[model samples]
Target: MLILLLAAPATAQPAPVIYLDQGWSKEDREWYYQVSQGSTALSYDLFLNLEVATGQDLFRSDANSDRYGLITQAANPRNNPDGLPIGLAKTVVTEGRSKGTYVGITCAACHNTQLNFKGKRIRVDGGVGNTFDMMAYVQALDDALQATLADSAKFGRLAGRLKASSPEAKTDLRKRFEREAARVHEYRTRTLASAITWGPARIDAIAMIVNRLTATLTGIPENTSTPLAPTKPPFLWNAPQATWTQWRGVQQDPIQRNLTETMGVFLDVDLQSKSPSEGLFDSNAAISNLQQIENLLTRLAPPQWPEEVFGKIDRKKAEAGKALFISICADCHNAWPYTWTEPNKHGKRFLLVGLVPQSYVGTDKGQFDALRPYAITGQLSDQLPPPLKGEKVIPTDQLYEALQEAVLAKALSKLKLTDAQAADLHGYREFPLPPKPMAVYKAAPRDGVWATPPFLHNGSVPNLYELLLPASERTKKFYVGREFDPVKVGLDTRSGTFLLDTTLRGNSNAGHSFEDGPLGNGVIGPRLSDEQRWAIIEYLKSIPEQAGRVTPFGGPPASPAR
Candidate 1:
């Protein structure tokens, strides 16, 4: 019998997760998955009881989950005992009337990554989540809610889990479900469901946050604008050590960036209240939690290449590529062990990332242009401070920043943090720096960039090899939410659920060409041969080993001669 059982076909075990050395310990990594940023998606019990469109368990592997590229995580005692996927955090609502454990997505949802190469799963902590489709996830949630409401059997199963056996209990459960359903539906229709589908790894974060504040929270439908610019989430590994963060290099204060992010992810707030004392600026934005996350990020070293899994780097090719980097790439993407620095309160130095003009880099101006437009904010205009206070219309970027700062300032006031404590929390910034407008996108260091695929600010380019080619020669449309191509050093575009049509407005993969062409229109460098392209990629793979502390003069010049 034992021999017969052994001979029988066994179930295939899941591919073991291989984590890269990105500074976080096992405990730290687990904690990162569970820590709350105060953005509530749904009540914890509700999420647990929720069913998919097919009436299957929400957490079960299904077509929707597969299509959405949602990572399946196993339960562990240290954190995520409920087996929530990476970035999904459940926390009790401390201040809201809806006081219960609620499921919310943390920074990890968009920043953490897991790539498949020959069936091996390699996780990159703080790397770009190039697969998770935010739109599809929201749509699935909406579908589940609607399906449960329409099907009595589904509701019964959900009610049973919540112990709502009685008619009154069932009625209350239905009402609670309805409320959540409505919220999800509204968010999906208003913000996420766009004409240009934000496939995997791309979202118009700024538009969504602004709309959430000005339109949804302020009850001003006029303030809502269709989210037009969907860009991939920026990696967080070196973000804490950067003087200017975000793709735009507009955010100087780290906590402000965190607060903006949490708010975008559904940070519950009482922004509609007419009176200040009536919790007008009060929010569930967890400043302490944001601070914790920021601190952890400071130690997050970029993931180095796993030569065992990804194949060994060619040292000769890397040496040749290093020469090309100094001449062609160093100006925009600083040299490793970044020499240029600025002072910080933590006694650590922050790199001064290059801010290349949008016209100069010429890779999809949609993201930069998205923030430049003005919007007609309704009654919230009255709540604005100074200058634009009485104006009905204001710049979208400015308005959102003002509102975010106000809410954050109030949240800090409640904490009663000492100046020194607050400075520490702000990544050493003594006071919050108000966001400023810049027509440029950041050109940050690419130490472990080989691990991050779908290159460029808008993630239009698939790999380093393709990125080196002329823009016209690049893949016009390709699939995302698939495996990594170790050789190409980018996403496996051969198969995926989301088809990224680069021909679309915001989705254009144009600009940032390396071909021999006219100077402007993103033709930044001399064209390279296929060998040179591969050589550069080879060097990029070895960068993680070479990163850390080099003299400014010892490295290549910071800017190009152009």
Candidate 2:
């Protein structure tokens, strides 16, 4: 029998020895900016219709007329202008029968965002993109494509752009477009029915992955949809050394983790029908892209606090805040000691990874439960249309486990990842990592927490100022997608146009309080006055400035002190 461990909510992890200044070289910052601004890991191009039967670009000419896509553009580190949105890179279908170069979205879409404070733009490379609305983008794409297809003039304009040869060709193109449009529409319709509505910056990422594997790819008979367990996509500055990733620590291998994410983006690994001219699949190319991106991100360092924009830090206040942080939040937010072994070419990097107990973090429970080994979250919704529902529920984790044990080719066939034209999309990894069920989240090295606001795993709270407030004083719902508020040290809650309702399933902001408690006390941390909380925030903002300092935990320097 395959071993799938369904772990209970574990306790908080021990703190790792962290330095006040994380030792990142200048080269690391340059590499990180490239990784941030470039690289898509071979996009699924969900924003574009990349899967049409004919190799035709039937998209509206004004596809990018709206300069900003889903979210606003921030400072461009490299200033490469191809008339594309930030974080979206341009790539071509090099080996496919359907030959065309297209722009694709990348990791930066969700990980990189801007904070506009008083007309000054502050670009936070690995920060929470709290303004992005992913679900809405998908739905809007569906609506726009459908609308474009229905209008005769619009269809004519698109046909002219495609340069269709004859009436018959145009007819064939329209039919092909209709088919592709329906595919997207069906996907949108099915996913929308789970009663899952995500506010800006939050998504049911795990659910999107599972749903693709079970319902969209496999065509599960039961049609049980995955639950909408939305959480904030994690920052990448400290990700290279993370013991595990995803809020629940579901992903361990960086290569596999990134591969699974590309699949979520709709990387076309397989063709529905074999294109005799173009061969079946591009496994090597796809894997190479993932590898390239993984390597690029390895050098990533967190965005430094912009003292120029935010103004010089109050050294006195910051120093006091650093002490307060060490005393109050270090238990869970502390960083670990990381080192590369000597003769590092063949030696692996090592970190004393500290894992946070999931059950103890008081923010939200919805995202934590996603990896419940025995829990069945992808059952067909009773609310789904009669034809799609009423079938026996197929346990999501069980089904995935069964598939994992099967032959790779055979499993791909079962999962609809392989087609007559293509044998497999590259089954290097399964959707959910073979279930070594972890029940805790990470204490997540507080390396770059300052820029990553809307704090907590689910992004339930907006900023440090609000986060430090008692739960009762926290706003239940507030607008997102506004400019940064420099004074508040968070997104401008006042001008937020998107209402993020915490009452939603995965958006509970009721945990991570810092009052009336101490280290090791289950949910809450040490008590702190408002001034102290601001001090801690000050320390966080100044993390990059404190480079080459004595290590926290009061010990001799490790590894020759950088």
Candidate 3:
């Protein structure tokens, strides 16, 4: 019997396993399975919620629902007038609209991977495999949505009903609807073109336009309400370090600026210049929303490893790579297991790096402008009439009063400004410099450096090997390499190999290869040899992956695919 049992099929009953708590153990697997199922469901729900919130369905008719009476309602006489329903109005009023949904194409749309025979993963990261032409997708979607919205018969019937109810209201409603529809159509066209032509710079411009337009239409502030506008699904990985309360060291003043200038409100009212007593805006509501967003983000999980796909690292190469990193890259490009005590506060700081000078320009301008409405007018909004050119200038005491009135008048449109708003926007804040020279600047902490290619803030460099070259060599006018093409560096071939003219020096705004004096100064090591450079790259590829935090209950992680 023992021999037979030993030779029994693999499916034979297994030996009894010990459990710390018998009752709990029996239910644990079921509980885990349930949790996993629940997570999957939550992920789906979050995806749909974000899709609706961001207005992504604007282009894709199949993903949209008529049940919500969105585009369909515009065709109904009771809702729309002037033979058209307002596009943005319907989108804002309608729950779950994504503004830039077409932009949020899936990862699979680009990065194609296959499981090898040995259950290993083979993935391509070149332009062929990692191509995400959002511009083309946007154009396609815009064309489709415009065609759908142009059904005149449906629009006329809706307009007729509105006119029947009230003539005056009908005209205004019709006009607003038409205007809004045109705006939406125009927005799609312009945004698609910009997304295709410009790269990172256009993102901010598009965001600004969206904020302004949304504010004008909704009567809601842009920073706070704009996120509520439809947006493309953003990547789930690398939730901005600034977003988390736990990762406080990475927090900088510019982040505060982003919250106020871009995000539309302050996370902490104390951080705002305005006092609580001054009821200029409801800081509490803004804070609550931020907290909600943070809570949601906290639960976002890392992408799951696909089944039958495992990675193998060259241990010898990795060890050598580590040495290279410590010697060559450790200064600025700090590695994992990072921890340091903050100098100012007694708090523990992690992932802190030196501040680059150029980054500060934006923050400076924002601060200067914040004081403008107050400095020029002495109030938050304009409410007073402009002083006559010849009118006696008010005394210093009365100047404050005059400014306050001006702010109120400006708010009410009672006052008109003679000059454009001040342009003293501040740049990003500076952090403590690293002890030694590091290869890169402004590179944020991510999963393994190797797996995440197209390195650098703007993703100017493609791989670690290219980045290993000293600034002197890499900064040459026409220098080219396997991945670091001059064209991609925002330069024409005639501009020579160096993306930026390091020879001309002093903030030329051509490429990023300026002298490392203020931002890039500090010597940690000598230039690397070709073999050493490749070895470092190999080491970077070998670093263990860090676990990402799971998306929370309300803020579920986005789908792995899209």
Candidate 4:
């Protein structure tokens, strides 16, 4: 049988709640850091003039203050001693390498965060970060790089560093400089005008990935990325065990997902092939490097609610909330310890994530539409580089089918690898094809959900409190990535927000209303009362602590009629 964590019988909602705290081992802390701080090296660092304005200097510019989020004084300062910003993971690696040293942001750049409640600050690993503007950071780098090329002094500084390297290295650097210059120009001239503001802590991930892999690198004409569909980058906690990945359960393969994400970050992969026997192209994105990241994540623990920072939880309310959770929320937001055995010969466990269809969950359709079959299929080009001459296209609305067969076939052919070999890679790289794009989103496990504020796949609803409100009443425009409002349970977006108007394309906060289903009177689910919503939220805060305590949430099934 497939490794699926099916919920208990429910007419509409569904119920298997997995307790995650059981498997956590303290020894895995090192592994967690390794996974979280993925590659302190950059893919394009071999070419870019990063050495010229390295460290905080790269982030410091007149265009914006806050050092482009280069440093933060987070509560749990791991590996950092100077009271620098949390998740400012960047370092120069010059020790023992064929290629010269390189530097860039790591996984921690987006995944780690600091939660401040009252006067207390607590660092949360594997939590959604809100410090840096990923889009703006890229733009800033491009602008600074462009400036360096034009200025004699700055160019001299860059040249001085390259002068010590081999002539071939110098030549490669020159080529890369020209290539980067062109790419920056293309971005500014072609895409910048159309680029929407992602502010901070949010990104149109796939759109940017398309831009990096297809339009920018391939130098293709038709590959225009849309930044309009911005969504918050999700926290990476207990993902290896997740049966389904992505905001929607579209991605089943973990390795492929990581590789795609790494590629999106521009992992210096050269496509120009010199010989067929040598392989398609060279990339600094090594298989082992990515493997290390994947391996470490499997052992990573989700960030628990910081009792130290947030103070003691009201056990009575939490207990009441736990019962309430079983009654109202257990249908869709169920969890359980899912360990795959047959296919996964090694006994590996994961907290299975539940996927709910749009027709039922009825949250914002923008995120779903952004990642629809059409979105990715549209970016697929039917051309290959020299030596591996073949048409590479999805050619169908069958998104997951194309991902499993067509996409892999094209990738395997390009890499000169066989199907059986690819299969042996791991469960991480291997993916199951969904029959069709169900137009659904994962009813994401509530692990560490307390720490990651500004809820929803698109980061639309500012807080959990707001998320529980009627769809119509949810704040339409709020500033995201501001100070934390511990009482409100999200960012302090009441004022000085970027005016995230939901009326704009891909920014709707409609659907997933409380008290709207068969049981309740609303459309999406039940229109939850304030007390009921508070109860559920309280239980979420207690998830990490309520280990192995099975709450028999076997309530009467709501009428299945949607």
For TM-score, the strongest prediction is 1
Tell me the tens digit of each residue's lDDT in model 1 across 198-255. Answer: 8888888888888887777777767677887889888876677666888888887878
**Per-candidate clashes, comma-separated:** 0, 8, 65, 25
RMSD of 1: 5.0
Candidate 2 structure quality by residue, lDDT tens digits, 434-487: 465456766666756777767778887878877776666788987776567655
lDDT of 4 by residue, 50-154 (tens): 432433243332223344543243223444332224333334333322144334456666776655444344555556766567766666667666776667566
**In candidate 4, which residue ranges exceed 4 Å CA deviation?**
1-66, 70-99, 118-120, 153-176, 184-195, 271-282, 336-350, 368-425, 428-437, 494-497, 516-522, 546-562
Candidate with maximal lDDT = 1
Order of models, best TM-score first: 1, 2, 4, 3
Which candidate would rank higher by TM-score, 1 or 3?
Answer: 1
Give the TM-score comparing model 4 with the true structure, all chains together.
0.73
Give the alpha carbon lDDT tens digit for every residue of 76-190 in model 3. Answer: 2332221121121111111112121111111122222111222222222111111222333333434433443465444344445444347776566456555434544544443
Error of 1 at 141 (Å): 0.3
Q: Estimate each model's TM-score.
A: 0.92, 0.73, 0.43, 0.73
Clashes of 2: 8
